[model samples]
Target: MRTLPTPPLCGEPATVRIELYTADSLDACAYTCTGHVIHVTAVVARAGMDAHPVGMAPDVDRPCGYVHVFPTGTLADEPAELSHPRWCDRDECQRRDQHRSRARRVDTNRPEAFIVDVALVQALHPAAEPMVRLTSVQGGAAASLVLSVGQTRVLRYRLANLLDLAGARPNGGRWT
Candidate 1:
């Protein structure tokens, strides 16, 4: 019912043999060269044993540097993002997480918290490219790729199947 931007895929999938993983960089940031990004989403994905992540997200106002008790939405504005990423949370971190772009939790404790963000990101990219990316951060790094809608779909489905094979539940449940 809602819409989420394509996750920001930030790096090259050089290690496709294992799992999609990489770090914070806009090198391979996902973009819709055609610029017609619609909304295809799976709002909440539970059904496994894991501690959901939570934080304030970030929003820097000036050069003094803005950190907080927790994270807030990213301060990296659409206009602020250049071809290169900074070493700060605003650029390297929150930007990749889609904090402001998707209204997603900068700290991303739960996906459900970002339902309202789904409808607010059609105009958030440079070069007239639709801001679409596919990335997931883990262990302080993210692996991104420039994939088509069909590729993303296949990847999502394949991951889902892998979970199924591993006996992980879906929607929200314990692994058996």
Candidate 2:
């Protein structure tokens, strides 16, 4: 129900372009979908990361990444079918009402469950490669593992790890 700003297109792949914007000092990422600019808060990675050889890599998997579209202004025009118990006079209720009004103002023609394309990348990794030095006369082989594309689950795991590392708590008092 929070108000967020529209992100301008900064960069994207062949199928999608990403625009980053800030609302209330929080960053939001937006992308184009079927000629409409849709705002997204988070891109959840569903596939796990794969280890690939530095020399030769295999083909990426399908549905390797899914664009989990959070509620956006474009998609806000339609009435929300899903509902939950809301506090009547609390600040949270006021915020929810504001979001509903904002969404009702936009003209989102598609249903609430439409899918959007998203790209995935590894956010964490070693920057410099480890040096392999030999002091003795014996010769040995050293290799480094590179990450593969279409590995969303790995990214999700990494995100969870980061949240834990930062001691972040889930909203609405829900914890897993």
Candidate 3:
């Protein structure tokens, strides 16, 4: 039997453990369980543990690890999509997996950002400086600025300095 639970969202803390077992087939060996003359193929290698067939799912609703983890829905006896293969290496299933990848690629991509809806300044740690946390419209953290109370005045001065600079202009003047 295999079990794969949905992974937590980004930045959400979670701990997971997976067990690998090999069962014998009833036809070949006298066992009632449907195991194969073959055991589960070891795909990953860990330092202390034996090689195991385990991997993280790239995205939701997409298959990862074994082929049977997310099998194609069958109509009658054949594969559902004729163009795609019935096995684990099906192209149709692969297309469904197109999303943010867990593994790193050769090309570097920047982290996504959104419009900030809220800006909160709080001292998360008593001994530490204040933190200016920017929250996106979706409520996720867009960015954070750790600064002292004096640094906040500097920021305010910098913004006001821009207003002063713009005031020097004729059209975009003060109060207009």
Candidate 4:
């Protein structure tokens, strides 16, 4: 897993929220948070669906929603573990991973299926906080988004294409 760049401390505490979406819908099962650092948890795919509650499983009848984290600062060196089962026997999950792995190996040159881009959206007042948002790009377009940091903290961003990002590091040094 590749990490994102961290921001310098203004000596102020900030809160960030990351929302995941797929195709036309918001993936309610996925959740993210960014503050002094970024943390991505509950990444549940079909292969790993068995790990989550049946109510939280991605709707196979519909497009799947994937949880992604792109921090303005460097993320942990290792991929965060899913709270649920790590692997599933579902063909869809296997197929998705296979396709993503191949694309990463050939295109992005990363070992994983996704590459996140973290950008500095703003520097709020000492009393003000910031938020982050994540959304899926339609038609597989070049993913780009705006992160609104503050009250309401609505994240407005797109998902970049899947590519290899295993060895890549954030432009700036790691946060921790």
TM-score of each: 0.25, 0.18, 0.25, 0.16
RMSD of 3: 19.4
Q: Candidate 4 lDDT, tens digit per residue, 28-87?
A: 332222332223323323222212222222432221222334332122232243221222
> lDDT values of the candidates?
0.30, 0.31, 0.31, 0.30
For residues 1-176, write the lDDT of model 2, one tens digit per residue: 33333333433321333333223221223333322332222321111111111111234221211222244422223344433223112233223332111111112344433222232122111242212111211135332323343244576699899989988886575442
**Candidate 1 — which residues are off by over 4 angstroms?**
1-100, 103-131, 136-143, 171-176
The superposed Cα distance between candidate 1 and the true structure at residue 111, in angstroms, equals 15
Candidate 2 lDDT (Cα, whole model)? 0.31
Candidate 3 residue 15 C-alpha distance from true site, Å: 24
Better of 1 and 2 by TM-score: 1
**Clash pairs of candidate 2?**
46-153, 47-152, 47-153, 48-153, 48-154
lDDT (Cα, tens digit) per residue for candidate 3, span 1-176: 22322222233221222333223211110111113101222221121222232333334232222223213212112334334212223323332422111221222133434444323243212343333333343345444344555766788799788978877444444243
> For candidate 2, what's the RMSD?
25.7
Model 3 is weakest, by summed lDDT over 10 consecutive residues, at 25-34
Output candidate 1 Cα RMSD. 24.1
Report how far off residue 17 is in candidate 1 (Å): 50
